[model samples]
Every structure is written in structure tokens, then in C-alpha cells.
Target: MSQTVNALEVKASPASNQTGYRSFELGSFAFSRDEYFAKVTWHVGGQKLSHVMSADAFLRAMMRDVAWGFFYGWVNFDPVIGTRNLYGKVELYAGAYHPAYKEKGLDLTETFDSREIMATFKAILDDWTNEGFDPFAAPDETDTTWVGKKNGNNRLAIERQRQACKRMPGLAGDAELRTDKNGYPVNRAFADVSQEEPEVHAEPGFEDEVHAFSLFAYLSRSDVTWNPSVSSVLERSLCCPTTEEYILPIKHGNDRVEWFIQLSDQIEWEIEDKQTGAPRAKVIMKAGDVAAMPADIRHQGYSKKRSMLLVWENATPGLPELYESGKLKPNPVEF
Candidate 1:
């Protein structure tokens, strides 16, 4: 795992097309934005290839990429454009995994120091995101204000820290419980959800140790959708519950099996082979339904309404190596 650390820098320059807007260069990929679209261009062989995404979509995906430290593995911004985290480094690519580009040998991929790409992405998001538009929020909750010249910056929304708890919310010295005073007012879609905290009857020495809080009440106050927050942790296991609406921004390629428990409402998942992107199956999960996203496949979820999903993960070190080496099966169970 030895690697060299390069000097961190923002690889962006002022774009000629828009005032206050910047175009970025990261390795072989170039990112530029206009009023309505964010374009990523790269060269393959002798031709220039470009892929476009709505400014909002591009910003949202970039927000996650910056927030998650590039995430576990592949973070497909769309079917054609995204980044693959190599931990200390990142692979910025266009059409690297898409069938059309792969078959024709037109795909492009370039690796960069993780810090270098992250800084450039952060600069791009800050310059492109306008005021009143939150890239981290659900589409309906935000507006179409990204389709114009930069009006102002929404640093508060874009820079908010992802929730992570040492034990659980409400515990002493741990994360604070979400409250209206803390700017986490209950979301409109979850108005009917109960806001009661659980009462725990603890004996003698267990007063500080025993605790409980209403998970649904906490989730009802979530400001962002499709962003999983760590709610509970025990050694290598983590319980990450998130609210979901619309489509998941990225197609997550798992290095290990990820279990999902549908806490409320419903979601439909489209599964594909991890390497080929070939269709695997469509799974529709309702409240109380549970499913496992296998390590061998990539999957994306679609939610018609804001729904709660609990993602159970095994964070044991070297698990991916075990899976890749054939020492472990891609699935949780053979059946």
C-alpha cells in the first residue's frame, strides 16, 4: 500500500464562457459548465469524447464524491461518466465501463492523486452551484436554479458535515439528537411520523449505558435524500439509515454484500453485473422487505416517495481482497 503523496492543488481555471464560473482539468478529463449543462470531455485514441449532464445532476454527484471521500469503489455519476476510488488515488473516466464505449475501445481513464481530484471537484461544485439550490437535497425540495450564471454560493448546504455517530444519537458525548432548533425540522413527506423518543428503564449502573431514541423521528428530520448516515456502529458492523426519493445518483459497485432493510414506503432496484453492466434483475421492495445487494453486481434504486432504508454493512478490513481472491462468495448466502 506504499504510495507517494503529491502536493495538493485545485486543477481549475476561469472558463471563458461564464463570469465567475470555472472549468476544471483532472488528469485526462476536463469539466466545463454552461447555463444548463456540465460537460466532461476526454480524448480516446484520436477523437475527443464528451458527455453532458444537467448542471444539478453533475453537482449532486460531485457533492457525494467529495463528501464520501470518493466512496468505496466506483461512483458512476451516470452510466458513462464517473470516478473509481483507488483509495490513495482516483480513476477519472469517461465510458470506461459502458458497453458501447468498451466494445469500440473508445473508453478513457486516467488516474490522479485522490487529493488533487477532490480539490478540483470541490472547486467545480462551489463555482457552479448557485444560491437557493442544494445539491444534497431531494430534487423536489430544491429548485431548478442551477441553470444560469452563478448567482451566489450555497456553502452551508454543500459543506454540511455528513452525520456519523460514535455510538448512537442522544448518548452522552456522542452525536446530538436531531431537533427543530438544530435546523432539522421534520420533512413534509414524513409529517405523520411519530416524534416520540423511546423510554428506557435502566437499573442501577445501567442508567447512562441504556438509551433509546425514535429512529423514525430522527429520520423525519433528514434534510438530504439518498445520503446514508451512520446511525450505529459496533466494531466492523455499521447500521446506516437513509431517506430516499427519486433516483440514486450513482450506480454503486459493491466490493462486498450490502444488506438493505426497507423501513418504510417502497423502492425498486435495478441490478446489473458488476463487470459487464448486463441486466441482472429488477427488485421491488416494500416496507419491512429486506434484500441483499451482492458483491458481484452493481445496483441502483428508484424511490417513488420518500422512503427509509437501512443499509447494513460489514466493514472488516481486507474484505474486498477476500472477495476478489475467491476466498469468499459474492453473496451472503448460497441459496
Candidate 2:
């Protein structure tokens, strides 16, 4: 068989909307936040097919399908919830469909090149990137430990963990040190966690008075996506956690409830239904702002600049079951 026989071409149709709608060969999908629901319309071969969906659900599905096609040469939507309301998942799995039903979304499924589909997917992402619309992302910039290159306007120096927690196996120990690219300590103040005990700062003349705590020291060294704990408040409550910029692509609601206290800068959060990935709200939080993450939904964050975020967690082991059993509401406060 000749490879040329399995070629595919894709481009955005003229119906594509700049902010709300994205057009594809088979259909167009709407991405509006204010709207309660999203819609996908199929305009192929004079046949019209359409599906209405929750906005969050659509975004999650769209992002996944596009990513799969672009990066893997095929698009699969099986993992998305609330999908039974839409067209069947576009896939060619073993014994999934009859020969006649093989081509539903793609015009020529048997002969279509995943690479060609990938190219089309890239086109869509490139357009979104240029327009400053990033909803799906998790780059290499995220670091739980303060270890990465500190670029312009970044001013902070901190120590790394000294050793793995005696309790948790496979966790990082204090080994990373403040060093130049050539592996030398950038300053005398820079030391490894293994080299020193936690400290507070004060001048020699003010030995008895403390100026600041070691938490600040750790903040100075973190990269864009850092999120780590520094304080244990109780059997289940936690504090002294911070998040770096460059948000993760997926939402996290695996836990029952999470807390956020804006330490510095601002972030735009996209909240969605956890099970269905349906859009619920968009929250803008700045320094001193606090928000509670409920168990019923997932949340994603967007930071325009390098910022510091303080997060608190409820580590109680049974919190999830309580929320699921309806004994506890997703919201912590009662109206």
C-alpha cells in the first residue's frame, strides 16, 4: 500500500469565531463562558448535526480531542463524561463498529494520516496561543521544589530539602542547593536544607528580635509551578503552601476541599463541574483573596505574571466520603 493514499487535509472553515466558536472540517464548537451551555454544529455534505453541552464539558473534550489528534495522530473522546448526549466517541477501536460505520467524523478514517490531523490540531492551538487563550497546559516550568533558573525581575534565594521525609519514601531530600549554572553557590546565604536548620532573619545587633521566617527563604527559590507544604496545622489542616505561575492544564478536585490565600499577585481561576467538566464560574483573586475549593468541581488557574499563592489543605482521610455521601456539602459555609 502507498502512504500517499492515506493523506488528509484540514483547515478552519470561515464560520470560525474569534473568541467564542472554533470551526473544524466536520463542525464548529462554541466556547462562551457567560453562556450556560456550549454547542457543536456539524455542517458537512449538506447534512446538519448538532449537540448542546455544558460549557466546561465541551472545553475539556475539545482540548483532549485536539491534543490527541495533534500529538498522537488520532482523536479520542471516550474519557469525557456527559458524552452520551453528543455523538459517539470518534475512534476506530477493535470491534467497535461495522465497516460501513467506520467513517463518522473523519471523511476517510481508514486512509487518514494521524500526522495530517495533528497538523490541523496544531493550527487551532497556534491560533489560540496567539490570541492569549490558553485553557489546556502543563509545561515543564512547574516545580514543587525551589529548583530552576530564576530569570529577570526574579529576586529570591532559598534552600532545598535536606533529605526525604523519614515517613514518606521516594520523596526528595535536601540536596538541591542555590548554585550558578556552573554548580557553585550563588551567595553565602544560599545553603542546602541538609546544611542548616530552619532559620529566622535579624541583624547582629538585634539577635533577640526576628525580622522574617524561613518560609520567605523557600519562596525566593521556587520556579513557576511550585506547590509545596511548609506547615502542619493539625491532624488534617495544613498551611504555608505556595504555588508558582504557569498553571497546570487539568483541574484538580480529587480532594474534598482545598483553600487558597493569595499571597502576592493575581490569578484567574476557571471552575468547573468535577464529574462532567462543566463550566460553573470564573474567579479573579489577588493578594489577600481567599477561596475554598469544593469537592464536586475541579479548578484551573491562570497567572499573568510570576506570583505567589498560599494554599491550605484538609488532609482528613474521610473528607471525600463525607462530601460524596451528602453529609457534607461541597461548600464549607452554610447559607
Candidate 3:
């Protein structure tokens, strides 16, 4: 059974009231829309596979999977299909075992009816080839902007700024500001490093009193556990947090370096070679420890207690090309 089947069976139209709903009308197949999900029945190689999944999830997954396929030369559909349970195993039997099954990755032929899916993914590849998008970037940034801020395309690709976490205090040096019990601004709140005035003195220059500021205070303030919240953004790089009991998902195979600072507690990370899926390293980061992840790896983290994790990312636009072209070393500080 040739895996070349047209699986997108366009059937129905969704109501107009649903917000942010889009039907796939790209390539030879159009979407068969429903109220909340997409019902696509693709006919490939004289076989039919019907899959119904949430519209938003499907689109996000498809785009991410296709993008991964472009960069890594393969994509895993089993994680998507197995977790989502949209299409049954029997429906995908014909396309499951393919010669192009490059790695232990999922079979992409299991989704599409024809080879046109390749073309769609290729379109995504074209962007990364030049004006590339960073899929592993935070939700606030995903698409690579080809033009300046004035471009409408750039506006469309923008993400909503996160509001939940703590913002950075514009202090050039540590202990520069002082605070009272009520977090009120004052001149002399604490002693400085000089230790002449008192045990804790204000950092030089002009000191200002702050109401209250502490890492323990910040970690205590967060009630939600396990989910990452953005804490601060320093230019294009910033730290987001995860108050974790378990671990975070390895979203996309990142093609660039990302730094991790264990602000408090510990996290055990299992890093694997991105392309080959081989174990590269196992690391344990304790409090105040920092680790830099290289581009050629995929990693996941586990924490025993509800711990604080500071995820630092480099949002430099041209970094991907720099690393891919061997212009920059994967390790920022070369030993």
C-alpha cells in the first residue's frame, strides 16, 4: 500500500460566531470544519483515515511538526497521535511503516493523503532557510520577521506580552536600592557592602528605599505550581520561571543555545542528541548553578520538590543562522 493517499476529506462548515477559527484551504485539500474541531477524512492509497481534533491544537501541532521535519529531517507523529488519540491505529496501519522512516520518529505519511503535505512543510522550510522563525522561542515570539516593524506581516506574527510574572527592577547594581518594612522608598534602608555604616549598607551612588524585594518573597508569591511564568526580559533575553514538582515538556527541538539558571532548589536534566536521539548528557543543577544548553540537543527536566527554575533564552534574530553556518560556537564561552 503506497503511503500516497489524500486524507483530507473536507466535509462541513463551522459557524461564523466562533472566534479565531480557520479552515485549511491551502494546497489541494480544503478543511471540513465543525463547531469546535476539524473532521478530516483523508483518502490515501485507496484507504481512508478520519481524524477529528481541536482546531487550534491541530493547527499548532501541524505547523510545529512540519517545521521540525524541515530542520531535523524528520518529525515524530506518534507523540501527537498517541497523546491526542485523534486517529485510531487501524486507520494509520498502511502509512505507519515507511522507508523514509529516518529515525524512531513518527510517520508523517500517517496523516496526509498525498505527497502534498511535503510541499506544505517545504514552504515552512523556506522561511528557516533565510528569514527563519524560531519555533523553540517563547509564545510571544515564534515567527521570524522578514521586514521592519512597519510591515503588516510582522504585526501578525507578534505575541501578546505575558502579564503574570515579576518585571525587572532597573537597578544597575545589586543592593543599590533600600526598602522599609512596608516596601516604601527611602534613602537608608539597609547597610552596604562596605559594612562601615552597619551590617548591610546601601550600594554606592544615590540610594533609594524600596518597599520590599526578595527572591524568597517572589517565589512565595506565586500560587500556581508546575507552570512557567515570565519573570523578566533583559533586552531580547530574559528569565521565565517554573515552580515545579515534576518537569516541563520538551516543546520543539531548539536549534540554538538557551541558558538555565537554577535560582533555587534543583532540577535533573536528561539531554539527548537532537538529530540522532542519543543520550548526550545527564546533569543535576543545584541552587545558584547555571547550565548552557547547546543547539544540537533536546532536553527535559525533573524536580523532586516544588522548585524554582529560571529559563534564560537568547532571542537574537540571526543567531540560528550564525550557529548553523559554524560562525558561532554552540558553547558561548569556549574552553
Candidate 4:
């Protein structure tokens, strides 16, 4: 069934209860925020259901959702409340596939145009985020002052674009080199990581075409965890290398096979069936280990120590439809 609809189903209301933070209604779900928490309220079968998240966490997750264009599949804000991307459409759900909520049949889901929720989410983030707090920064790197009313805006912090290069960093026509003035300093934990850049020897005419950058060195300065930055793009294939620490904020349900090349440290992944949330397997990947997350399942990562990961994805349009139609296998290898 097509989830796409012609008209927007979301409605924006004035500041909720004089807090000056606007409340939003997307179909049946109502979103409101106070000083410290973001609340979602809805009615299901005569029962009023509610879900809440820390304002910081809500803003963090929503920032990614808005930035990634809603991402490929499920972007679970918590285990209970989140969204699923249907490309042009989105599914806003509370407890839809979560085992505890699903078992009790209390799950509620509403589909909306991708633009509808995207706009509402962006507004919510803008209103709730304060001047001093940065939702994108790691907990230790940023302040814990997300409480109280909005004072000023952090557009520079929240709106920072993930690095995406046409060819390579430092190349004349490609992405620029990250510098100290650029605010991408080496993370404290990654102090031992080298700051060396790769030297490329190319044919006389291929100086611009042949280039290289140290992926480890580039990733050592990352300020955010579990967020992938596109280091290189070749057609539909993307090499997204990211720094990882702590738990992945969301359980990502893939619409296509995602390959992981563990570059440093270790990450233990909790894999579950995409539709049912049933246990599938536990994968512990150490340095130099590689794994493939099938499109048919959802997975979340746990990194005890700071680590580096290379996430390779195929961003070809309409790939999800091919997987759903059985025209393409969800797993990269059948055997």
C-alpha cells in the first residue's frame, strides 16, 4: 500500500501552556515540551497513551532525523517512540514494534508525508534547544544545561552539515581539510591517533584525480558518536566513517544491506528481526573484523570504549521497493 498522501496531516498549535515551546499535532499524536522533557500524547481505543523523552535526547535524535532526511528505516528515539521512513512518507509510531507494547496491543502508528513530520520536528528542535547546549555533541564534550526556556539559538551547532566529499579531502576541487579553527579538534580519548595526512603519488596529469586522506586521522577529531559522516561518495555507494562511543541512540532498521568494517576498538551489536523484534544474533566485532547487517533486521550497537567504524551503504534510489518486492535479497550474501 502506498503511504504517500497529497495533503499534510500535521497541525501546528501555539505555545503549549505558556512555556513558549510550540506543541505539534501529527494526526492523532500530540507533541509538547517543557523545560526538561518532550512529551507525546495520543488516544487509542478510548485510552490516552503518553510517551516522554529527555529534552536533550529528543533534540539529539530529531536533529539526526531532520539531517539524514529521516534516514533509511526506523529511527527509534527511544525503544517506545520513533519514526520509520518510507522515502516520500514517514511512519510516526509509539510502541508499534516494541515487544512490551506490541504484546499488549497498545501500539499506535500514523503515516504522514515526509515533509509534514520533517517540518514539525525541525520546529520542535528549534524551540526546545537552548543557546549553550549542543545536541550533536557527546555528553562529556557539551554542557547539561538543556533545562529552562529557550534563551538563544544554537544554529551553528545543530545545523552543522555532515562532511560529504565528491572526491577526497585536501584535493583542490573536493572537501577542505579539517583544522583546529574549524572546531574539529582531536577527541581526548583519541589523542594517540595520528594527525598525518596521506601522500598520493599520481601520474603527471592525475594530481586532482588521485588523492587520499587518512580515515583514522579524519575520524579521530569527530565530536559526535554514532553519527556517520560521508567521507567519500562514488555513485550510489557511500563510505561513511564515524567515531563510536557508548550506545547507539537508535535501533536502526535497515531497508538495505549495510556493511560495517571495524577500524578500531570493538562494538557489540544487538541484532533483532526487523518486523517482530525477536532475537536474531549477538555480534561482537573487534578491530579489523567486518560484518553485514541484513536489510531484513534491525540492529543497535554498543561500544564500551571509543572506537572508529566504517559504514558502507548503497544509497541507490528505489532500493527499498526492490527489497520489499523480493526483486532483491536483503542479505548481501545468500550462502
Q: Lowest-lDDT window of 10 residues in candidate 1? A: 1-10
> If ranked by TM-score, best first, what sequence of candidates would result?
1, 4, 3, 2
Which numbered prediction scores highest in lDDT against the true structure? Answer: 1
lDDT by residue for model 4 (1-335), tens: 01222353445665556566667777788888888888999888889999898888888888878877888888888778889999889999999988887888889999988888887777667767888888777777677778876566777777777777775667787777676888888898799999988778999999778878877888998877877888878888999888888777678889888999999999999999887778899999999999999999988888888899999989999888889899999888966
What would the per-residue lDDT of candidate 1 be over residues 178-217, giving only the tens digit for each residue? 9999899999899999998888999999988999999999
Better of 1 and 4 by lDDT: 1
**TM match of model 3 to true structure:** 0.47
After superposition, candidate 1 runs with Cα above 4 Å error: 1-7, 15-19
Clashes of each: 0, 10, 22, 0
Q: Per-residue lDDT tens digits of candidate 2, residues 166-220?
A: 2221123422323344243322222332334346566787754443234444444
Instruction: Give candidate 4 misplaced runs (Cα > 4 Å).
Output: 1-13, 16-20, 99-105, 148-151
lDDT of each: 0.86, 0.43, 0.44, 0.83
Estimate TM-scores for all models: 0.94, 0.43, 0.47, 0.89
CA shift at 280, candidate 4, in angstroms?
Answer: 2.5
Give the per-residue lDDT of model 3 (tens digit) for 1-335: 01212352332233234432223333223344343454445444454555565533443444444322222222223222311111111112212323333343323334443234434333322221213332223223334332111112221221212223334532343322222443433212112212222233556643544323454434433333334445566777656664544544332345578878887778898876655456788989998999988876666677776567777766566776677788987777876
What value of lDDT does candidate 1 attain over all alpha carbons?
Answer: 0.86
lDDT of 2 at 283: 85
Lowest summed lDDT window (length 10), candidate 2 = 146-155
